[model samples]
Target: MADWQGVSEFVAVAETASFTKAAQRLGTSTAHVSRQVSLLEDRLDTRLLFRTTRRVSLTDEGDTYFQHCRLLLDGLREAESALTQLKESPRGQIKLTAPVTYGEQMIMPIILDFMIQYPDVEIDVDLTNNQLDLIDSGCDFAIRLGRLANSSLVCKRLATRKLIVCGSPTYLATNGTPHTLSELGQHNCLRGQHDYWRFREDGRERNIRISGSLRCNSGIALLDAAKQGSGLIQLPDYYLQTALDEGSVVRVLNNYQDLEEGIWALFPHRRLQPLRVKMLVAFLTDALTNKVL
Candidate 1:
């Protein structure tokens, strides 16, 4: 307590540039404030301020110390505020957006469970493939999959999903498995929204353009095509996991598979997020990390 005795008073004096004003703001006597500040400078063995009859100014060392102390003080205040918020139930609406299929398959279920637990909280979910501006659309946060583009939004990684390139066992038996990246040319490769598939070759990333008899934007439809032995299909693990486990589809080019993509919750920069938003983000993080969603 002795070490901390005059720090607040000194900071107040530095900010107000008046011992009397600092005392007034702190609800303490001017002589007490001056005495504390004097004791602080004596303890630190440095002159922190240049006192004048009309005004006060900080020394060079004092200015640097003040900057660090200001940050510490802010962190302390935020901690107190967070504690206060924790004592109250999170009651408000959380507006969020995510990719259409993932939102339906993974995120929505967890959100529904959260809503059940917190009856006072309301959620507005917008599922779309298009990347909407969170600030413009008035969303608190968004769920993004795959490789994210460089942006100013703050991100929290929730999980990761692998992209798999697979074909039905019957198709591979007849068409022959691809042994090398170049062999992909001779084989029919199913295309989704993009005509290319991402891969990592020899420690570098590559996008290989492919073509086949069928082209569809729906992952479910493409998974069906691969099941019926239409051709090779590349999709996320969520779509191909069940088929792969059931032996209906066989993964190929494991060595060339791209690194697992991130599952992230992104938010616009704000000084302090509301308790509800923080709670929802925490809930989603735990659920996704545990694979409960």
Candidate 2:
């Protein structure tokens, strides 16, 4: 029989595409992982990977082997998880990812509350705008906003937030509010991250390309600029709620509000997910549903 230890090393390397990263994930030395992979390749009598100074890539045979091995590993993990489920108390670390702003303002608090309830469970959160592959990054799940593209991951809805177009009263007074989507071309639109703004017109979604002297990726910076009467800005309700309530900003084009975007927890489609991941998703869903926004 092939050594299961060697198979695991090969799987890790294949998934991460870096021996150093695989070793770090497995909590082993680079040399140890390399040796195991070498031994496995020798036993199989085929080169599993093409190693270079920069990265490791799988050979055709290796790719086929990895697909089967990953399924086997997943099955093993699921079997173990099934047994752990019987214990009824979830334990272990859950690695998760989320966008910087929302993660900080919304998800982090719920995660902290979950930790309080399950003292034995630990969480590692990666806050970034980049979308990471859950299996490649070894993350249990990710919190995503807006419409998701086609992916193999399973998604669970947590909440929905409306998209709003707004600007400071001064900005609207000076530049005039856009009454229709076509009028947007006549005004300066402060952009955040993307140059296109989403809107709904006549039961269809439309993306309008916007231009201005000032552009930023930070939502807070854009909001600040909008509040200072720089230009009209489009953002989600969560970001503008306080400003709208305090009369610092006013929502315009209410009729053009984009479809409400959903907040979702996305995870790998596995037959048996760990109890900690399941519980966290359930907890966040409940907590977010109770939130007014």
In order of appearance, the predictions have TM-scores of: 0.70, 0.80
Instruction: Give the residue spans of candidate 1 off by over 4 A.
Output: 1-84
lDDT of 2 by residue, 1-293 (tens): 55685998998899788998889988999999999999999998999999999889999999999999889989999888788889768999999999999999889999999999999999999999999988777888999998999997889899998889999999989998888989988888898778899988899999989898788888889899999999898888888878999999998999988878899989876434689889999999998877735
Native-referenced Cα lDDT, model 1 = 0.86
Tens-place lDDT digits, model 1, residues 48-94: 89998888999997888777766666677689767868766888889
lDDT of 1 at 157: 91
Task: Kindly give the stretch of ten consecutive residues in candidate 1 with the minimal lDDT sum.
Answer: 268-277
* Count of backbone collisions within predicted model 1: 0
lDDT of each: 0.86, 0.89
